[model samples]
Target: MTEPMRISIVLVDDHPVVRDGLRGMLESAGDLAVVGEASDGPAAVELVARTDPDVVLMDLRMPGGSGVDAITELTRRRIRGHVLVLTTYDTDRDIMAALEAGATGYLLKDARREELFAGVRATARGESVLSPSVATRVVSRVRADTTELSDREGEVLRLVARGRSNREIARTLFVSEATVKTHLTHVYEKLGVGDRAAAVAVAYERRLLGD
Candidate 1:
């Protein structure tokens, strides 16, 4: 029989009750283990270094430091763990910043117990998860950023919005598929989008393409 995947977790929250509750929930899962807890970002980093958990459930606004800062530090140090942000704030800036800082997932504190558990498991497996509400905010922010794109880039984005594959886009633009793919990459970076669906949604929202 295949062994169940073992997950070591660290909880980083300022509230004791929250930490305790999470620990209980996680421990109830046969394969999940709580290795340590931290009341602030600094403590979280220290505990993570010591425990070397597979995942870190990080709170955004802590007393000693910000979760984003912690993520930056951990990523810089090349920590071998996924950071799953668990916070009350779902602002676009916060979501984008966390993702940029190397967080594997973003989930609101109000998530259902099952959803939280699923997020932890998915993050441990290297999947990127974001709350639906947070995703909408991120889409909006990316759309806003598209206004700065050059005309050619806008053309490429419009083709992307129209559901054209890179090859099709290349044919339409009389350019190589590799060039089209490169343009798409630039569009994604400029819009801060990680995927084609997001790029299309942002383009539509910004009136860069007709819906």
Candidate 2:
């Protein structure tokens, strides 16, 4: 039988006890190895660079160095290891900050050992994993953003869905063609789409354009 590939890891948390517990828990799985550890963000960055582990388990609120900043710096330096945030705080601010800073995954400290192990393995493969609550918050935020189109933008999208050209839309809404183009641009941004066809599809998919 072929031996399983060992997934190397670096643990980055300020607390010695937390690191020790994590190391023991992860190493208990035959394919996971704790290759190095750091007590702060700066140290974590250095350790990550030195060890070149497959995954870096990061903590957000260390006294000396912030995990978000460490992830940002790692991104800036183009480090090879994927960062998986393992922190106590799952607030919108904390979760968004770490993800925006290039964390590959986010798992709360209360996660089960199996979940933690799975999160590490997923991160090693460059997959995005989020705790259930965190995922809910992120999805809600995205939905809220996409649903915030202005009344005028909504009118523009509805018309576009009906096969109206920009000129036709401006004429129907008593606006200039330039204004129609501008509204479409804003609609594209809000819907996170590239152009008119994509915007219309996303709008209907989200039920923004009702019958």
Candidate 3:
């Protein structure tokens, strides 16, 4: 028989009941093990260092520090675990900050049991899983910013939107491939999209490029 993938997890929340409930749910999954629990951000960091879980289900608002702070600290220390934020806050600022701070995934507190379990596993596997509502919010914000691109940047973005490769775009624009890459990077930041496909979609949705 193939061995099940073991996921070591750490739970961090201010409420005991919440922590207990999550622990029970995680433990019931044969491959998941709750290695440690923390009631606050500071404790969470200490336990994470000592236990070295593969994934951390971190609560955003905690007593000693915010989940964002914990994520920042952990990343600075070069910890290998992925931080999957499990919080009630769905504000754009909170979501963006957490993502920018290196959180691998985000799930709201009201997520179903299956989603919670799936999210933990996904994070352990280095995949991003955003709650549906959170995903919509993020997509909306990116779409809203698509108009901020410069003309040359927009040209690069339009070609990118049409599934053109960087080399192809460079050839079409009579520019160096390195210059095309530079424009692509600027386009990504301005549009708030992570990659070429996402940037292209955002440009089309926002009418930043002519169809």
- Measured against the true structure, the TM-scores of the candidates, in listed sequence, are 0.69, 0.71, 0.69
Flag the better candidate by TM-score, 2 or 3: 2
- Positional deviation of residue 201's Cα in model 3 after best superposition, in angstroms: 27
Q: Best candidate per lDDT, number?
A: 2
lDDT of each: 0.88, 0.92, 0.90
Q: Write the per-residue lDDT of candidate 1 for residues 138-189, one digit (tens) a residue.
A: 7777666644777888898887777798889889999999898888888888
Candidate 1 C-alpha error for residue 148, in Å: 3.9
Name the TM-score of candidate 1: 0.69
Best of the two (1, 2) by lDDT:
2
Give every collision pair in model 2. none
**RMSD for each of the candidates:** 10.6, 9.6, 11.1
Model 3, 115-161: lDDT tens per residue?
99999999998999999999999898776654488899989888887
The 10 consecutive residues of candidate 1 with the worst lDDT sum are 202-211
**RMSD in Å for candidate 1, one decimal?**
10.6
